[model samples]
Target: MQNDAFMHVRKMFPDLSSHRHRDMKVSVATEIKWVVFYRATITTRDGNYQHTIGQRKTLSFKDAKIINLQYCMGVCTRQLPCQNSGYTDPRECSECRCPEGYGGTFCENMAESTIPDCGGELNATSTYQTLQMEGDFQAPSGSSCAWRITVSLEGGYRSFYRTLLGRSM
Candidate 1:
């Protein structure tokens, strides 16, 4: 790998100096559409029997136990994990976040904050709600993302508690 691939990479990326260490990569050397993929067939005899299946790329930039796709998978048949680190479970991500007033691993643990308040019960279900947002703002206000949560108490059992993680960006 260091003999041929390294030379090719050095020629392709001139910015890479001799002292700098580079990462290994995997890519599709050619375009191939499993001949053709039809309902229940995987034909390879193009002119004759052809299935209609799509193509996939096994592109991994790093040499880890996992595969990657930074260039984005056009039509991947198999689901791939993201290349980002420090991420726990991407799926099943429903957990109460402990903001400034609280702190912990999954944001599940809470503590008293410098911002004093008449503490009582935090009813998450009734006091707060969840909303989906998609956008990045330049300024603040109407665009400013500063927000605080409220608590609603129904009885011995708390109901409403909300969290706005990562200021709207």
Candidate 2:
């Protein structure tokens, strides 16, 4: 695997001088399905650093069936305006990929929830506060809930929230 990877990199960067193996991660999806992730940092003769990632999927070990051997170079930059803890979409460079609870082009609005009265804005004070939510135990599959918490920055003061405990039924 190392020799094959080196040869592949040499083909792409012909002037590759040095390379270092960074990390390898393995995830098991099922008894016969597995995913392997590889990361490496390479340097060329021109002193340019490149970060590379490779993903390999194995379907069966008995038959040695491997598929979707994908590789990517460089990091995805946040070129688009992603608001409210969102991030730029690597597949669509011009768009933002919002979080689970955020929507809109730039993730500025709250995402719609399947449960009624599930999401809303709440104000936070300097003192500790509690926000509790209860729902039917037998909710349908794919039901979702969300909330947006905000705090006013008056008098040059900042506020933060800490979760003491969280549980899902």
Runs with alpha carbons beyond 4 Å of true place in candidate 1: 1-102, 111-114, 118-158, 162-169
Scored by CA lDDT, what does every candidate get?
A: 0.25, 0.37
The TM-score, computed over Cα atoms with residue i paired to residue i, of candidate 2 is: 0.37
Cα deviation of 77, candidate 1, in Å: 26
Q: lDDT (0-100) at residue 155 of candidate 2?
A: 50
Q: Give lDDT: candidate 1, residue 50.
A: 23
Error of 1 at 7 (Å): 56
Worst 10 residues of 2 by lDDT: 26-35
Best of the candidates, lDDT: 2
Q: Give TM-scores for every candidate, taking all chains together and pairing residue i with residue i.
A: 0.17, 0.37
Deviation in Å, model 2, residue 58 alpha carbon: 19
Displacement of residue 83 (Cα, Å) in model 1 is 22
